[model samples]
Target: MRVSFLLFAGLLLAAVVSGCGGGSAASSEAASSGNTASGFTSSAAIAVTDPVTVGTLKGMSDALVVGDHIVVRSRSDAFVTLNGQPVYPGTRLSVLDKQGKLVSTTDYGFTLAAGYTGDWVMMLSPDGFIMVQSTSGTRLQHFDAQARLVGGVTDLYPTVAATSTTEYAAAENGGAVDGNGFWLATTFSLLPVTDKTQYVLKLCKFDFSGRQLTPPFMISTSALHPRVAAAGGAVLAGWLEGGGGMLAMWSKGAGAPTIRSINTGGSQPYPLVLTTDGKMGVLWNGKATMTSTGGVMGVMIDNYGTPLLATGRTDLTQETLSAHWDGNVRATVIDAHAYKGGIAIAGSAVGALKAGEPITDVLVLADYTLGTDPLSSSAQTILRFTLPGRAALGPTPVLRQMLFDDHAVLLIGDDNRLQAVYTTRNR
Candidate 1:
């Protein structure tokens, strides 16, 4: 395992925009009431923490809060040929305590081949196990509550052997459930049938034991950018189709998945979030034709694949700021969390840029109640933070709401350094 570390001289502080108001820290009344009195109110103080060092990387590939410690998975910067196979970089897992102190670090010797198409998995199971599946899908490593690797299982099916130039975001092709196992929605090319090849999309479920729990469910012959989410014993698989997107909802004993097309403008749906109340929230970019500026649109759907809102859609960017994407400067949704009776959306935006100014990025956190029209005009609080440091945005920032329920953190990497901030529902 090759490890590299960079030491910083000064501390960077984030600039917070205070106009938007947040609700009380995990207050049930604030959560139950679907309203934000101020154009921006203070529910969470949005505390800024000093950057947590994790070494050189594009950005945090994935991050999840387990207990009070944060387990972060990052791909290293070094690239080399191992065993005659050109590879990208080795995978490293780091655990950090509440005070931004590093607890432990583990380096998986395996490196993903260049142009690997499979999406990796790092999820926390309900029983307090941190499951890390390699991009190859050949090995499943388990970590105890203390972030220690106890043992691992191997040899189910390897998905990373095939190389494709097509790029993918983290968890773009797969997702996991808390208590249940994870699901993968992918396409496989079948052998030549009548001298012609055919591609088929499939959704498969596998438990932590590295065992396939159910037979693969057929989705469609062709689909792009597949995403999955499961909750309340129901699973949702979605993919880009035509100019919009298609969704399929299925349960354990259900006959088949119910399919529907969603109108999300031109951008693909992202970050599928299943709430505790058997509701699913789908978010997408509402971009106009030939314009970099776009609004974030969201919709709430019940487990039965039925719309829950009046119009079945909420314009999140309208209540906040529009996400603009230029040649390099870009902003889009990253992650979200469903709270007791509300939900919070996290995004990244480009800060003010000049010829000689250090490039800064902004973190957008928008909170909304989960009642009728959660993101209604009067029900959302959007907060923006100008992050510290001069770094070019490549790897998207990683945002994870802590398990404590009252706090959330964002990991930003630039110039081979990692920085973080914590947001809370307090003044």
Candidate 2:
């Protein structure tokens, strides 16, 4: 794991040095809006609010909501306390609507934060720990959303595996439900110390009513950094499993997961993403021997983790990458040489049936490829019209949070600002 982290850091440094400089604020804002002839549309106006400037250094950890508001977690150095005593560095969470107006703000008063945006409810916790706060701390603490903190310390750290340390909270239904709409899915690790290292992957479901729908259920493999996507009543989770050697998916209402190992010849699973409609994709360096052999691979999956379509290597070497899905179609953006040179690929599901055989979906890759003439790409020129305010993008950008709602596609970049691309025609 340590080696993997070091390798990732080195790759990131190399990308930054070779890629173009960070994009300017103006260029990041000038991207186009509305549907294109190619079937791509502008972000839904409902999800976009006027941009709010929180601080000079906008950490990637800040939270933003597309539809009603955008929340910027103010940088710690610029902390201003309501009463007295310094608020923890990452303790401030701001709120704003689509019009960029300030809706509300809260002082978490602690450090180490985690959060997920839903339709109406935003779940937040500090240091992988969600608990009730006492009134002895400060007056500002009393004003925040106060939900009854349940369970004991043992219930919190149910597992002791090293890989189980970092837990991410995701909304099962875009956090948009009132009665039975959405629930919070908390994915974490339970590591048991022994002669051999092992981990237990667990997912705890909590309804909007703040009650535990079910206790944490363990998945068989050691999957890390799992992501969940929900559509209708179905929930899909994709994660790096089996010591980061395999990509796995499990559906809440769809039964057991069907795991697939990427034949990368000893390369880590890398990052995996699934579209709102349940399409699955993964990106990784092809082999440990070569630097230029890195590429992205994608597959379309049914509710039962069955692959409906598959896309072979889309070669990318020493480049920063990101991907998102527009329904069953997958779209990827690659910035090589520091955001100077870039390529965009859009893939659709194509399939045919064989005599006496069931139909299998095939992924047909189409080049919407955009880059500088020949070579020497310019960051400003590549994504200027797509992601405004995002500059010197990284490979992780390809897997940044892309939320698909009924009306539009929400492109949340590493910068924490969001771009909404609508799908339906305006009435």
Model 1 accuracy (lDDT, Cα): 0.53
lDDT of 2 by residue, 186-229 (tens): 33322333345443455445543245565655653454444444
Give the per-residue lDDT digits (tens) of candidate 1, residues 1-427: 0011121112223444232123222111111122334333434334445344444444456667777778776665444666896544435667766544456776653543244423356677655554433333434556676656666455445443234334221122455663567776655553222234334567878787667888877887666667777766677877776666778877545778888776564566664554653467666666532234455556666655654554533433342223321112244544667765566666655543322344455455666665554343324544544443433345545555443555556566542556555556541
Q: Top model by TM-score, which number?
A: 1
What stretches of model 1 exceed 4 Å from their correct place? Answer: 1-45, 50-58, 81-87, 111-119, 126-139, 146-148, 158-172, 191-199, 251-254, 288-293, 309-333, 351-360, 374-378, 389-403
Worst 10 residues of 1 by lDDT: 1-10
- Global lDDT of each model? 0.53, 0.30
What are the models' TM-scores? Answer: 0.71, 0.45
